[model samples]
Target chain A: MADDQICPKCGAPLPADVAPGHCPKCLMQVGFESQDQAVADPAEAPTAVSGHSGVTWDLDQLASLFPELEIIKQVGIGGMGVVYQARQKQLDRFVAVKLVRPDLCDDPTFSERFTREARAMARLSHPAIINVFDFGQREQFYFFIMEFVDGTNLRQLMQSEGLDATQALAVVPQICEALQYAHDEGIVHRDIKPENILVDTKGRIKIADFGLAKLINPEATDFTLTGAKQVMGTPHYMAPEQLERPLEVDHRADIYSLGVVIYEMLTGELPLGRFSSPSEKVQIDVRLDEVVLRALQKEPEKRYQQVSGIKTDIEAVSASPTGHSPRQSVVPPTVRQAFNNLQYPGYGLYCVVNC
Target chain B: MDDAGFPSPHSGRFATTRWSIVQAAGVQATPNSRHALEELCATYWYPLYAYVRRRGYQADDAQDLTQSFVLSLLERNAVQRADPDRGRFRSFLLGSLNKFLSDETRKQGAQKRGGDRKILSINVDDVENRYQLEPTDDITPEAVFERRWALTVLDAALTRLQGDYERVGKLPLFEALRGHIGADKSTIPNREVAESLSMQEGAVKVAAHRLRQEYRDALRAEIAQTVTNSKELDDELTGLFQTLSGT
Candidate 1:
């Protein structure tokens, strides 16, 4: 009878005939699967078919391939490849073995690039980063032996017991430390989402899959491989430049993604299409909104120049007491100076004394 | 599997749906089984009517054909031919209807056969009025049936949710928060609703989230009734979403 109204959730035009008061598409999607299951669509991440021989490997076959380790079982399957938990015979410890998808290795120069990037990843040694033990091409399979994280990922944590403002505050700084460490080593983690961030039982954050994005898909310009329906990285966490001008994306893109992760952790929602500030959505310090908003800035130049800056700002906010009014005069010049001094390791301690 | 004859393992909310009851009854139609089928037919008759109309039938002829087909299905034990293993009610209905339509010998005789036996209480004017608003895109009759079926399923689920809220005397709250059924609550203005209902903003957010969870369970329950088991429920839902979004 009238022009069709648009659905706010999915942006699809609601059918004119059926006035169900809710978006029919989204409603059908709700019936499709629970929120958690839909996020990891099985179609996108198929079970791994090991090697280029088109033969699916059983545990025995996988164990035979890697004689040095006891192949436990398949732990995870991503667009990149499969991850298997195994114990190194010589080292007598658990390690995650990541196999590069055989299809990805079809590129002629893949071996050279993989070796180069894998070395860089191996060189990165930080508590907040998953340690890369060994990487090499074993037969047709390019594998990476990494430190196994014996805990759930950030995505699972957020889905199960949603993070409160306090828990989110603690998690952000650790992510910043890990990201900053990798960034300084001249390796940019093109894909930095909650799924890649692992949290152990002791509540320690470890960022995984550093430089693997570049190693998998060398051309950053082709962000989403829509032809294969294989998303390189979660688009919601991607910076504007990653989607628009992918070639120019630098370490700041990782900062933008970290901003998205922080916002999602705080509010349990993606900051999509004129979203409200995190403080407005949840009970948090109002000043922390500035840090989130700046990191989420559309232009790369406007965001935090370094990943450590996000940590400094978050730490500064955590150091101060809550319920303080948002006034420029409230933050003393000493605290403002601490903001400029990005490399100050004890900025939070300094803020506690001064402001 | 037991003295009851119906599968016993399917317990709790999924124990005995109308389709499952009819499937369990097989060719022998008991009174209880017959009543369950009738109730299901009444709820889902519109999609069949829409499908008939989309297949190039005129208003009066399409109405007669759908009614006659449904009558034959109810009275003649036609569901006996529906494969017991393929337990999806939607697929069985579509297949049986197609078979009935394709039989030229029975088609002419079945038309205007059940003029006095109107078991379903479907409003003719209202049904045609809704059909007129159907998109005139170049979609097949099967696609039309599927999309209409998906809408009908969601409508039934929403109506059930509304009825639940109504019984608890929370219809006003349901009305205010219905728009957020499948939406992210954070993106919506909970404070506005909170002030209007004189509720704490946090309490309103919790209420909204609970409503969404309830709505999801209701929709799942509705879908669960159509398929044979819990496993097929997700597959059926995925199919419904694809059908609706494809158009």
Candidate 2:
């Protein structure tokens, strides 16, 4: 029972657990039978931005709530709640306002916990982190006004145009810088996945929802809140310690999740039971395998003690000229400058070679 | 008329389905709508049972909970209480079941209240056997429910296709061509099937094409029964596909 058996009609791998006879992937394609006709109807096209939740607030209603800013439209809906792109009247600049789901606010201690974590998140000011400007409650809805990155998240980027090994290499180091900054501020982003990592049009990484997962659902073990298929945060990128010993989870857990994200970016599959390394799955530098494997170690103590260690290893591989072509060494100058400013003394030499 | 066992797209037979009828009634249940809701419950009960089991209940306890939950849904006319905006029976059922389980947990040991008052004829042993085959990985209970729900939709559609073939006395043809329903024509072994069915290779090709078209229709109709409009149908289809493909 090979899991990698690809379906003939649709090239997606046939799920191994599906009962034998019909390809589940093919059957899923059958489920999309009406999409062809549906796409033809222009009226149905704009429904993508509208919230899928049963209780959706119209633009007029949302506009009334925020008189200071102009509510443009709903941008996204996720586990925490809905995000609307807006413009600050005074600054005349675009910002994203995220309204926390009303159900999550039912807890009496929610506001107190929210303020504490939000203040900590607001303290984290980095080029790679989405900066939280302000947060407050109004009319039964708690909202966070934040800097808007005018580009798609990593998930959309991966889905729309698959990332190459070069693109992946360029992205991981930026993420490491962001994670290291947040860790120094004593903030651990429990939920670190592709969805939270936003890449601007300039190819700069801006990580969103820094500590919102813990603020929303304090009880990490409670899976019941994710009812009706509303994914609070995916467990695929979760480390073993996050699930097994949640009370003892620390910044090291974030390192483990980063390893999973790196694995998925390099190879388009999750690193599930006895999965192969990134180099084995793709045409990546073989030296990178030890970096990913070390970060993904089951024990937090066994993994990289700090996020900077992963960045140092990744930079070392990217700097080496043997495996990849010079074309692959096109590291964005902004990212290279950010790394040079860091405490890594020898990093400037690698930047000279790679850039 | 178009082909044996394949209905024309404009046949109007699928204009109304069980879910659409239930949704249209909207808190005012006609006998017809009630019966439609019951039929849907009967067909999709296994996923709910699997959800309960994955939620860390014993097989016996899970069976009892599922039976009671479905019984209560019909008896209380819970379809009327379903939020119309949700627009999908799958979400409503899962949401209601979660609420029911929470209520049941508060009244612990009240599992015997249903007391063999079975409304749906679910084979306990068969369901448990199927449950055992589920991948024992780190998937969430919601993930299990979602995957099972997707499988149930596909299984229902496949069953309906089989029924259509059986009614037209093309059961053997269906069994032969089922594997190639959504497969490439070049990949399908048309020559072997033509020899076995004592038909021309050209005829086998036509039959395989018709089977694929009919399957798409059957699956669309199956999904349409669960969603309210064409937009929601596409959304549900895409969502379920993502669930299965782990994208």
Candidate 3:
């Protein structure tokens, strides 16, 4: 029963000294030599701010804010605050710190919403969601420490290597799980795009930035209400209901965003972007087109009732003969052919289309 | 990855007590189905203990109150009363413990009677270890209890893996291998590890592979026990990492 004595292939008992882990007979039958090779030595040790030199900061001061970490350098930025590569002193781990832009921190409403949303996100304990450890305000800067995911975002991934069905299949389950957890917790992730989805070194998806989530049953009254509605979130992936009525919308909005993601993954082009005519652009596979179309329906009632239902549809499409091919309904055949012609540079096409 | 024997963490992992009662419906169900009751008791032990101790009881008096509470539960087969469809275990356990604490308080010397047997097989040493680990000024006994619960789960997971390793005589190597996963990225000079173990570097690689596989199995098994369904395994595993790393 010793771990070393067990054959990895057959799970059969073997003596420690003689057991080679792989079933010897199986190996012989397959003419396989146990290469036992190291998979491409993990991407060169992640360096500090090597990718984020544009932004600047006072290292000593930022380090004080995160008393538990050794702030190495400022990394990058997007619509969100500046990112930093810092080493967590206590855990001897490296983490990414996202500091809210100074101007946004000054807005009391934004600050409250941020804290509440962050707490909601924290409650969402899922593999696909990047873990958020602590959030605090220090010296006029509000920051949150997150698991420093090593690897690129889906945007980066798709840009270099347009997602093949295999890569897309790998992440679909992870995203569904994260969304399911968030939805179950009654928090609707308003934004779901490639940029917000991170892929760690192990190829696990990590959804980031639940900054716009609104709790279904909030403990306190609305802190940032503007005439009973809060206008927020990205537009491209926004559900139709989100555009027509922001506050009243529920988890179906996220399902719509996920549909956009699925569409981009398959067609290598967005379904709802500026096109001469939506149908004329891509080769929309039938079932996928219907799912995406239903998700984007202007009315919340018309969309998938639960994120889990969308997951089931995605799973079915993935299992079917078409294998995640963009159904022809939304993606016109001509556009699908063009998308197929465009080779994934290195990261993937889905990343570029969504990014 | 497999689901047949695996427990589902969501639908019935904690099994809201109310569901069991509705299912039982005036008949005694099997004992193994009583996990919902055990889990509720285990998670809320300290909250109940704090309520008892605060009611002005000596250590033994508090112990007796706890015992009677558990004994009353065993005698009544209270789990059968748990209707997960109608109520949460949190409210039920709190209500039950509160009544037990109040009745024991009125009796004055309830410590001398029918509740002396140990109801909970808790490791007091582990509890103290957790208490000591907390910041001295910031922690209260209640907080210590919560920490102990978290630590208990970690201990269980580790112990489960260690036992599996031991069964295969790979325990010693596992001890050495555990550090490889999350250690700081300091250079380890393979030659040093090889020399210290009196093994060749090639052999060390082989050992590392075996170690990683065992660790994965151990980690998976640890995650499996907490969740009833295989689908939740990844989420639970992530939770474990986040809990350990304080992420």
Local distance difference test, per candidate?
A: 0.74, 0.73, 0.52
Q: Compose the digit string of candidate 2's lDDT tens values, residues B83-117.
A: 87998889999998998889946225446666466
Stretches of candidate 2 above 4 Å error? A1-54, A219-232, A324-355, B1-247
Q: Candidate 1 residues A1-355, lDDT tens each?
A: 2457777778888777866557788888776544333234542232122224333454666788899998764555565766877889998888999887667677699899999999999999999999999999877788999999866678767764577888889989999988898899888998888889988756788899998876755674333443212224556676777655657879998998898889889888877665666665666677776787778877789889999999998998888867644433344444344334323122222222122
Off by over 4 Å in 1: A1-39, A42-55, A220-231, A324-355, B1-247
TM-score of chain B of 2: 0.91
**Ranked candidates, highest lDDT first:** 1, 2, 3
lDDT (tens digit, per residue) of candidate 3 on A281-315: 44433555556666555567877887777768767
Candidate rank order under TM-score: 1, 2, 3
Model 2 sits at an interface RMSD, in angstroms, of 18.6
The candidate that achieves the highest DockQ relative to the unseen native structure: 1
lDDT of 3 by residue, B1-247 (tens): 1111111121112321323432453246455445544544554455455545545555556656766676566556765555454343434555566556556453444455534565676444443343333433344443433333333444444566576556444576556544442221132233566676665543444355434433344444443544434445555455444432233
Backbone clash count, each prediction separately: 0, 0, 43
TM-score per model over all chains? 0.49, 0.48, 0.43
**What are the chain B TM-scores of all models?**
0.91, 0.91, 0.56
In candidate 1, which residue pairs get closer than 3 Å at backbone N, Cα or C atoms, i.e. clash? none
Per-residue lDDT of B1-247 in model 1, one digit per residue for the tens? 0011111121122445678888888899999878878877887898998999999999887888888888888898787999877789999998998998888766787885865567788788789998998888898899999999999998898888898777545688888888777775556678898788876664466566556756776787787778777767778888898887874
